[model samples]
Target: MSAFLSARRLALLATRCPRRTLSTTPRWSADPWPLPHTAQHLSNTQTPSDIPPPTPIPRPGESEETLRARLVYQSRKRGTLESDLLLSTFARDHLGKMDETELKEYDKLLDEPDWDIYYWATEGRSPPERWAKSSVLEKLTIHAKNEGKVVRRMPPL
Candidate 1:
């Protein structure tokens, strides 16, 4: 009698529960939900690229303290990881001691592409004529060499 009751209960539960079917569609469909008209237009028009914008020239009468802070931030936030570590560490070690002229040169250096700067710093590629004579670049290359010291991480601000 107990076995019969158990069978009947199983039948009832099976009938009451709905069967689930696997979806034929992919989990990530190519079809995205509709966007607003303006957004759709912008999305279609804009293509992503790696180029960074030109760094702005220093404002007239900008204070040295403010310039140093800005350079530190830019150095720390360079888009590529290699450049970020190298530049941030270099800035921490050098920026405070740099005068207004040197700071301006460093700011211009920041405007160059990350790979170019990284290669130049590491001595993997020769810098262009403009940078070849720059004292700032010389200092950066010296810092990047790391010599006997290993630079495993970025220095704190």
Candidate 2:
């Protein structure tokens, strides 16, 4: 009876404790669930560098209507809410009447960082020397002043 009980105890211990094999390779590599190929590639890919890509140039011989539509879209979609409202409102009011030169200038303004443009428009910070003489910047600043009307939302595109 004593020998039988000891055998039963050994059996229980054996069932409870899993056998661990010594392996030089990592256990994760042996996992049954494999990572998706795209996910694995992304994990190994280098992170984006600090330098921004070059600004996009307008398509050659683009129509004035197309240019205005593009600029209005850009104005309405500025990442920051303040700039979005100000620029979109300005675009709605002024873009249609702008000549080719003014439209080009406004395109250059859109290329600037949103916060910088916002500050310049609001007179919170004076524009840098490069932008000081920009007619588009002047127009944006005047619009941002909201002289008689309060601008609370982005105007429809």
lDDT of 2 at 4: 100
Instruction: Give the whole-model CA lDDT for all candidates, comma-separated.
Output: 0.80, 0.79
Error of 2 at 7 (Å): 48
Candidate 2 wrong stretches, greater than 4 Å: 1-56
Clashes of each: 0, 0
CA shift of 103, model 2, Å: 0.3
**Candidate 2 per-residue lDDT over residues 1-157, each given as its tens digit:** 9999999999998899977879998868643543323344323432334545338685899998899999999999988677788888889889988999999889888987776678778876677776899988998888888888774676765
Please write out the lDDT profile of model 1 over residues 101-129, one tens digit for every residue.
Answer: 89999999998877778777877667777
Candidate 2's displacement at residue 62, Å, is 1.0
lDDT of 2 at 83: 77
Residue 122 of model 1: what lDDT? 76
